[model samples]
Target: MFKGALDNIPDRVKVFLLSLTIMFCMISTVYANFYIGIDKVYTHIFYVPIILAGIWYRRKAIYVALGLGLFYIVACTVHDSIIDPDTILRFLIFLVVAGVVGSLSRARERFHSKELQAERAFRRVAKDLQLVLESTDEGIYTTDIEGRCTLINVAGARMLGYGTEEIPGRKMHQLIHHTRANGTPCPAEECCVSRSRITGVGCRISDDIFWRKDGTAFPVEYSSYPIISDEAVIGSVVAFRDITKRKQADEVRSRLAAIVESTDDAIIGTTLDGIVTTWNAGAERIYGYTAKEIIGRHISLTAPPDVKDEIAGILGRIRSGGRFEHYETVRRKKDGALINVSLTISPIVNNAGDITGASAIARDITENKRVERELQEAKAQAEMYNDLLSHDINNINQIGTGYLELALSAPNLDRGVRELLDRSLEALQNSSRLIHNVRKMQEMKATAGKLAPVDICPLLDEIRAEYSGARNGEVRIDLACGNHTRAMANDLLKEVFSNIVGNAIKHSAGPVHVGIASEEISLNNKTYCKVSVEDNGPGIPDDLKPKLFSRFQRGNTKASGRGLGLYLVKNLVEGYGGRVSVEDRVAGDPSKGSRFVIMLPASA
Candidate 1:
């Protein structure tokens, strides 16, 4: 093959044939008329191809061309006379041409070969670039300023669910329509691609949904770079990627966030540096700070001053990818009120299982604190009253029983003795009634358990029977309770009625009337039952009514038993998911006496 390439050269070498023709013509002209100067036109024919071939071909080809020129000179010289001036000049010129062409041709050949190699290298690079662009998984498409598709890689075509025939000349907008996920058109009027095409380079539109040829929607992220030539935007190149999975994950995250914000518990998130990143609606209501005010602030701002070290430790643990559970602490609200909150904090992590930040959920226990304080105070008072009742009632019973024993043992007892015995019996019964009242107050102090709905009527009847057994002839007990009476705790209901009836008998100079009523009311998105116990006795003093339910407090000093009778009544009434307050029966009826109202939760 190599020999064939050279064999195809013309039969006569260009240099030899030209040189021979020139020498023959020169010799003939010299002989024919002894002409003085020659035009030397044929000399040029010999020199030009030799120089060109030397610049274009390799060293060997250049030497062959020179040899042909030498052969022509030798042949022409043999036929002509020796030592002639014209012949000498022709030979000299031929020698000069041969030397210049041979030397320069070799150098030129090397330079020209190097240049050709560079061109080939550039072509290879271009081919490689095409392969890379075509093979990438991400879709690549370039467009012109007129919104026409200028180029689409194989990946781009496949991404739009199209073949090559459908893509090359198609307009970009026609092949793939742009719209919001909600189906709103994202046309030229609102498209960043269109806007950037008219304005400048490096503009982008994110979170857009592209409808493919198959009529299926997919999320896309695209960046457009305007191609400028001579200070004008000739076209744009868009690099796009499918982000359907990313968008779906974002939607799921948004839904879960909404659920957390809707809950009653406070939910919040912080960065690795303990900076608050997110705050929910429940946090707003509990902490008294709006999301706008709290986001991006340090989480330490919500922590109590004393708990800063504690919070720092917790954050350190979270940064180390540890979870902190049920850490009870006091958090300060925007209003400067200290809140008792139960906190659960955990490390928020990425797919690689690296700690990104921390998230916390807090539950408010302010009302629970208030109830605990009230309970403690009620307990202290009950113990004091119980001690007093045990002492006073026992003393009273001992004296009355001692007098009765003396009368029974005396054989010849006088009328005076009988009268004294009757008086003693009456005093003993009064002591028994006071002791019964003390027992009811003790029962009230018992902690309430899980509540179950109970009818109040039967509970009150029992109180009536217990009180009737102990009452002296001076007092009459009556039971007039509404049939609809219902409440949560049976023990609380009994305590309430017992305290009220006992109070009436202790303070009243004569007959005491007890009346119980119930009704329904709406509160906190639920219905509740309100039960009121009214008594016809000397009304509670205005100054004492406010603290009527306070510990170690008594309505009347002369009344038997400890002061906790009323306080216990109040606590028991409120403890069983109810509230109690004392008011006059008839606004102005101080004479008509005191009425205690109680509110209880009812079944949904």
Candidate 2:
């Protein structure tokens, strides 16, 4: 009740004034016949302001009360009829009692105020710390000594699926369903929160699964420290952080490391400071250096002296966001033997998406290079013979056709001779179609011309609709290209795609379906326009695929005439600077026909 009354004063000055008034009233009793009677209980009212002022104003109120008590006693002495030792002693005793009470009350008030200030300051610091913790992207949570939640930051709340309002003052261990990252339970005895309460220090904990509000689980890392007061454990502040992303990244890194280690190509990495950071098993096999021996060492140690300039150039390009692909070079191995290697170097990007270092994948292509050279020599000799045969065949066919016509027009020819001449012309027609295949093979191998931009979507549609309309078939043309795509010459694309569609229509036993699509593709840092023609028909036999693109090769020689459609397609496409290949349609069953892909440069 007294605390409530003292609470009214807003300032220390008001407390001092109130204390003075009460002290004056208390002294009035001392002068009233100097009779300090039980009615002096009224003087106890003066204790009100004395206690209030002491608690509120401290030393200031104590001094005012003491002065008021003494002044009252001096005024009583001057106004009274007689001066007596008992009166003086009584006045002195009263003065001492008032002073003692004021002093004691003031002391207690100072102590209480200091404690209140300390508490306010602590709360302020906590507010600021909480703001900082929540603002960070990392998860943070705090638990008390009894393993109850005192605070959980926003990031922590999101990670654990528990809000601060939902978990604070609640025992965290009971609510948190602990498990391993792989979903196995983490037994209560080994839990970090329980252990931290027993040990009054901070320690790192790993591989714990934290439960979500909906009962789902995610991995987290827990670090806990006990809060001590007066050398005794009061509570603990445990910081729990969700390490799911970190763990995932670690798994990916491990997988990538395993891939590089198991590969035949040498994979090595260096830090920006020039020290080797990673050396895989492939590196060990090729370079003859154990990973333990070379790691943490400079890469320049094994580099050949002549390659110093090349290495500098590669590093410069990588720093400028360029990749080095198929860069053939020589390097000395640990055995002091020079080895030929094809190096592919790229930048190793950090979490901030900046290149922090570089990686090199080295392939020993010495045998491959040697075999490729031999193959080129053999192919040149064979092509030379084929071209000569095609030229000779063409000349013979022209001479035979001209002579047959000239012989038939002779004035004295008999009906029997005319019939023989007609039979010979029919045989020559069959021979001429066979010769066209050889000519096509030579054309396909000829040097290509510069690629010019051509749009072939409309042309493809035109051919499909025209053929379908002419044949009056149920086959449908599905044109999926919306945007205009540019490729090589129109005539070349038309020849290739028309042959592919025509082949599909001929081979299909039922209603044929055709689809055309175009897109841009990048390969070896160069972009190209790609067009695909797909059909639903009987698939090509695996045995026939070897000769599928060769001249005079046909799936059904009876239905597909002359075996020159695809042969002509191959020649025309290559002459315009493009490539042609086949694959199964994505949506079609294995029984259905396949798709043929034609990749051409958008422009030279």
For each candidate, the alpha-carbon lDDT, in order, equals 0.72, 0.72
Q: What is the TM-score of candidate 1?
A: 0.48
**Position 178, candidate 2: lDDT:** 60
lDDT of 1 by residue, 1-604 (tens): 6333443566467456545654554455445433544432234444544544443343434454545455445544544534446645654665565556656766655676898899899999989988988888878777787888878888878888987567765667755766667877766746666667788747777777667788998888888788898999887777788988888899999999789879989888989888888898999999999989989899888888888788789989988878867877799999889999889999999999899999999999888888999999998898888889788878878877887887768888888878778766756865675576656655655545657778766776777677763455555556666546566776556667776777777777666666666677778886677767777788887888888778867776455444666776777766776788889987966667888877877654
Q: Against the true structure, what is every candidate's RMSD?
A: 17.2, 12.6
Off by over 4 Å in 2: 1-158, 163-165, 168-171, 178-187, 198-203, 225-237, 271-276, 286-289, 292-308, 328-341, 351-355, 387-441, 450-604
Candidate No. with top TM-score: 2
How much is the lDDT of residue 275 in candidate 1? 85
Give a tens-digit lDDT track for model 2, residues 1-604. Answer: 6664665656776756785666566566655635644322233444556555565655555565565555545545555545546545654554555567667766766777998899999999988987899798666656666677777778777776766688788877767756665767677567766666677766777877777888888787777777788998777776777787999999999998789878999998987655789898888888899989999998876788877666667777888779888988788799987778899899999889999889999988777877888999988987787668767876787789789989998998999999899678656755675676455445444524634577766876777676673246667777776465677664445657766887777677667788878777878777677878888777776667668888667784335356777767776776766778877775435466788888877654
Q: Which pairs of residues clash in candidate 1, taking residues 3 or more apart in a chain or in different chains?
A: none
Count of clashes, each model: 0, 4
* Candidate 2, backbone clash total: 4
Error at 581, model 2, angstroms:
21
